[model samples]
Target: MTDFVDNVAFIGLGAMGYAMAKNIRKKMAPTGTLYVFDVFGRVCEKFRDEFKSFGPIVIVESPKEAAAMSQTIISIVPGAKEVRDVYLNNNSGVIVAPKNEDRLIMECSTIDSQSSREVGQALGTAGTGKYIDTPVSTRMQGGVPGADSGTLSFLIGHSKPSDTDPISHRLEKVATMMGNPKKFFYCGKLGAGLAAKISNNYLSCSILLAVAEAMAIGIRSGVDEKLLHEVIQNSTGQNFMADVVQPVPGVVPDAPSSNNYRLGFKTQMMIKDLGLGVDAGYATGIKPTMAEAAYRVYENAAVDPKCIDRDGSSVYLHITTTQEDHQE
Candidate 1:
């Protein structure tokens, strides 16, 4: 077909995974063959249709089927549990499949550091593949453009390292070819990238929660919402949360808050990442005091029907509105 990348496959059709695979097929044209598998058959079929113009797309039944067809695989799933199931599960997982070859496995999911290492270790033990975690972050409020336009950032670490190595270079090459080369940060060691991502997200959720609280206080205290944001954004209080998330809708233009929090990172996903950080804290004997507080707030919000399918930034609105409801 276009160009045969029979060696490359993607193992998930989650929002980001689907979009990245679709765009990579179009732009990179991986051997006119980009094998794909998803737990959802409909998503796989839909992607198979949409991706045909760029390459030969296969809708496989299991992770093993996808692995059999490609020498390089990229997995972008929801979290650690799914990651474990897809690559390590004995029944039909990739590593346990018969006749598997040495492949490059790049994990782009936002999984915990522990899981990353565990998966990497398993691959090593099984002699199945070279594993690397290049967990990425982006404002996925938009669609494929978020990945295609080079807006996503990749944080990477490999299970093995050497000055002159085969695997990491290939991992870097494919990532650079498929994504924005400039956005990648190659952290050392297999689990370093995941640790970095957890810390980064911990700060993100923590600050977003604080921004929500501060914005609610400002609005209730008679400070003009727009004016208060303008002042704070230009002052020492500014962060991505206030500057971008803008918990108060009218304060920022084109923000998720302004759009009813649709099409942005989901509120529950934020709590899930926070949970990973909290788990790390317990493992390391360090208390993630602020993260625990942020976790509690988002945990409470995640269960609220009001926050369902809402953007993570909606946590600010949830806190403010709940407080007002209690006071009333």
Candidate 2:
């Protein structure tokens, strides 16, 4: 009631959004309620049941309804198209909703930096709600487990619409509940968060592709897969995808590959994120060699019936399998 921006609504209940929303509810529930809304009502329904221990998880019908009811809105949908639909679409989106100068509209999706800037422009033109792009980093392999533990680092970016806004002051407090408050970094200026996130993800996806291909080559060259992994992990070539989510099975006991690469960041999503990075490069007149190459790798694997739904680590299998097919 007395805290800054007591009412909060989360428009997307996907992995990160759900975790962040749960944390916000746990922290802000006593003072106010956390409103949950998604294009898919089932996600909100399931989230409502899961957050019983926390204060009320109020569900709403649409994004516009969510904005109307809450002082702060956090949306973490997939890409730029979805972002535009949620914030800029006039018929059903939040941009046309009744003016509320006190509200904060935050987009947490990893989209092109230009889209973030345009969305901020739309918000300013609408004359209601300050907008910010708060894209999170791709180092977030924590999945829902980390959300359950409440330890995700967030990056905040201030757009032109948020130039003079004090929404971040409220965020400084609310962000601590979402993850390590100390890890929160303000990138400054609109789309900076998206740019930063895309940059981080570009490294992640590109390294994943490069490492997977390298692993496939090592395996084909008669190098023991797990042994190579251990050597690399102990050597200077180690990384999260190599050491933690090692694409090779039995290399890392907890890696997705150990369990058939069933559940983690999907191959399709990785391709999508990589494409965003590629777009960023195009916008800046720079060639995204690694990112584009990685995108092509993932794109090839994504269409494979086997790799379509598998974890991004499955790119290892994709590479090895393609090489096998080529040899025959």
User: What's the CA error at residue 295 for candidate 1, in Å?
Assistant: 1.3
lDDT of 1 at 144: 39
lDDT (Cα, tens digit) per residue for candidate 2, span 51-153: 8576777898777888777878888887889999988877778887778866877777878889889989888788768788876654452455655577666
Alpha-carbon lDDT, every model: 0.79, 0.79
lDDT of 1 by residue, 16-96 (tens): 887778666775554557888888889989988877877778778888877777778888988789999998889888877
Tell me the lDDT of candidate 1.
0.79
Q: lDDT, candidate 2, residue 206?
A: 89
Question: Each prediction's TM-score against the native?
Answer: 0.92, 0.90
In lDDT terms, how accurate is model 2?
Answer: 0.79
